[model samples]
Target: MVLPPPSHSRPSGALARRAVLLGTAAWCVGATGCSGGAKSPAAGIAPAASAPRTPSAASSSASASPSAPGTPSASGPAASAGPGGALPRARPWQPGPGEIQPEVKVAAVRLVEALGTWSRGQGTDRAAADRAAALGIPEALAAQLAVRAGSLRPHADAAVVRVIDAQYGGILSDTASVLVVCDQPTLAGAAVRPGGTTVDVRLSRTSDGWEVTALHPAAPGPAEALGPMAREVLAQSRIELPPASVADIRSGAVHDSVLRAMLQLAGSHRMSISVVRSGHPLDVFGTDHPSDHPLGRAFDVWRIDGHAVVDPASSRTLISAFMRAAAAAGSYNVGGPIQLTGGATANQFFSDDTHHDHVHVGFTA
Candidate 1:
């Protein structure tokens, strides 16, 4: 294939036209739409904006462990073949209950588009790549998908995506990550590929909307599968986390003991809760000891079963019981508004103003 020459051609008065374009932009700033589309050179993904917190709610079935047998995907709209034997129409994400923040919604939409197309049935790798790119998946993640998609055969059925969870947080900035769990069941009842269900998507707000900056399980050998018990917590709870937390799970940075304790706690409680921090930097307010969160050895719960930690009386009893449960489950340290005492130990629990709003659960080893 021969290429065309690089012809340096120009129209007359090109320089004068450049001046006119600049003038147009200048006045447009005072007007609507034009100046609003300003781009960030470094973070070319999305513009900055606020994502206020709201109550969270979700409903989903539990996913099983690796050794656990998969339940067959029953005949349904998802199993039906469309034109060209394409997968069925997967549902798009919509804000439910607490996910009403503007920035969060944008992130969720972009994530759905990216994964929804990447895992859609019946498309060549090239087609998948094109679809992902069109949906604004960052090159960091898209490059990875292109290689993986190249080997797979197109699907005989469409896939389904469920919004498992979402987390939004930052220091003097607006940032978020949305967790989408998907599946394309085969007649044999196995996943399209094992560990393909979980995806942690990163995004930041732009003037236009939330733009995805990265995605987890991005470069893959295999994704970590969340067992049935773990999925229950994710589906019903507000375990908000940053990309770093997702990376921890991917790279085996988080300890199994910590994970085990969390699942045990969730199952007993039967209510969704908020994880304010996990596997990220030590967000020490005023030069205290470095926190365990950055090491994936600790997690803080700010909300439990749809109740804020700071809430009084009825909420207090729940928080107190949960803290004890954390201790019995091998948490070496726990902190919150309500302090506890007695044998297994008193030093293990602490009460302070900083913790007035949430319960901090920490683990050793």
Candidate 2:
């Protein structure tokens, strides 16, 4: 559309001046009533400031004018709205014990937002058990463990094993990982109390899902190391690291090739070690477990490279040979049934559906 030239337009100053003059005249009316009989409409015209103003859509929707005797403005008494546009006259939300605030979703806690949001929930049926098995928090298992432990106090929902530090033991491909232990409050009003309660929790990742195979107290052996391992895995996997540092589960000090070496040396025949399911304590026992095992030096042996080794089925060649090597090395103690059935190893060991699929080995300095 064609527009008029800039020179033809009147300046804004003219309008502003008129508005000011009208305001001054309104003020003079209050100071002095007209000596003449009746006042003219133009004489008492309201000031621009006093006139009703159009409210912006972004601001309040109501328009405002001078207040009359005892009436409220058109904005209507300010009130808050509920789910719908209708205002809620009463009964606003009041937070109660164990009540999760609407605003405090997984995102609300900044530091643990990822842990809370991204962690896949264990199936509902097994949520408590799954949480226990997953090394969640003490209070988590406490709720259930309390049932078994025979107590009724609320306890920590999960225990956190955080990375305390990382130290490279200097190039023989050795590095030390440190971890700080804490607790996660899943259940409200739960406390771990002093001296701490124990639960066994296994950490396993499958192609389809991540599973905690076991949950129990910190045992004396390899399982004690699981907390450290869990912490390292949780941190290193999430952060950038040095090139020499290894990211694979096996590379870590926890799951070195010692297990393979132990099994291979014991078996006389060609033996392969395949992981049936690899996780922490949960894979080994329930949360009420009495003792912790393989904290730093234990592992469960499953198949010998896809070959079943449990039940009536016995592995020949490999079992005997692996035991001989272990006996020769004399670095640590080796137990289990590689020597039994004409094989050259000890059969003094424990077995279960958890360890049935594979053999678990632990390391000790």
Candidate 3:
């Protein structure tokens, strides 16, 4: 399961990026650069049906009893400046491939944050409105959120949405769309449980930067399927990646079978994955042949059960055994520091200085 990292754009459902924005770049399956998935941008925002809504008095049900649930039912928040006040510029930042555009990032972060709004967090109607204005959000939306905060409702901390992955929803000269995948370990209600939520954010270039114009849910795609051990390894292990890589995994855009094999290895032996860039453009670094990592079909393990492949004193049995295990898990190619002489095909395993410190496992599917 992999959900694209989170973002917000206009709310439209069951449409292609092409359908959303005509004459823009087409989306692809890979997060590296595409916009094939997700609904088209709409003129306004809408609440995600799958997303948890602030409970009403009639339904306070959740895994945990709501502490103080219900919309501020007593009063309506004041609205503020409308299209009357000038909005941001019509044209602004345009990023190139592999670039980290700050404007886009800023809009992406704020979009998710805006959803976590609560009367409780701000403590008053005025407080929520103040924050929304500061973030360049519409005043009416802030008031709506402020009045929705119930005394028994969980705090923002109870259900934190951390955006772990991001991708381009679509790009144009002045307008852009972003897809962000977030892991919501604690949603408002106890029954919500922990899971992934993808936010499709539409942004328009502005004089200062990018500002979100709309938001909606992502189209059906791989969902972030990390289990406890996989999550732990991603947190504690030495794995490092380029911006697109995390989004790839977090979105569940990578091959599921391969990811499962890697996760299983990590869970059993506490392996630390060192690399997974083999299938992308960056894979051209050390070898001439095409690599599987770019295809999301392979991963490299730098340490096994706490033993480094490069350590002279590291036990050979551990490395060899791990390689065998990888093979058993359906990997067609396994490379590491230790070379086996028997019980394997000649081309099945390899050892060289290039992989002296890591074990590379490649799956074919």
TM-score of each: 0.45, 0.26, 0.35
Q: Candidate 3 has what TM-score?
A: 0.35
The whole-model lDDT of each prediction reads 0.38, 0.22, 0.42
Off by over 4 Å in 2: 1-214, 217-295, 328-331, 338-364
How many pairs of residues collide in each model? Answer: 5, 77, 48
Where in model 1 is the C-alpha error above 4 Å? 1-89, 100-102, 117-121, 133-158, 169-174, 181-195, 207-209, 218-256, 259-267, 271-324, 327-361
Any idea how many clashes model 3 has?
Answer: 48
Ten-residue segment with the worst summed lDDT in candidate 1? 31-40
Model 1, 1-365: lDDT tens digits are 11110011111111111101112222122110000001111111111121111111122222211221111122222433443443333333333332235344344434444433433343444554555555445444554544432112124233333222333222112333333333323211232321123333444544454445544322112236665544543444444432223333444445666677777787676433223222122323212234454455666554566554644533677888988998888877777677677516546776554355456677765
Model 3 residue runs over 4 Å out of place are: 1-33, 37-50, 53-99, 117-131, 140-158, 165-167, 170-172, 185-196, 206-208, 218-365
Q: What is the C-alpha RMSD of each candidate to the true structure, in Å?
A: 16.0, 35.9, 16.1
Q: Model 3: per-residue lDDT, tens digit, 248-284? A: 4554545766666765665567664433431122121
Clashing pairs in 1: 47-205, 47-206, 55-98, 87-158, 88-158
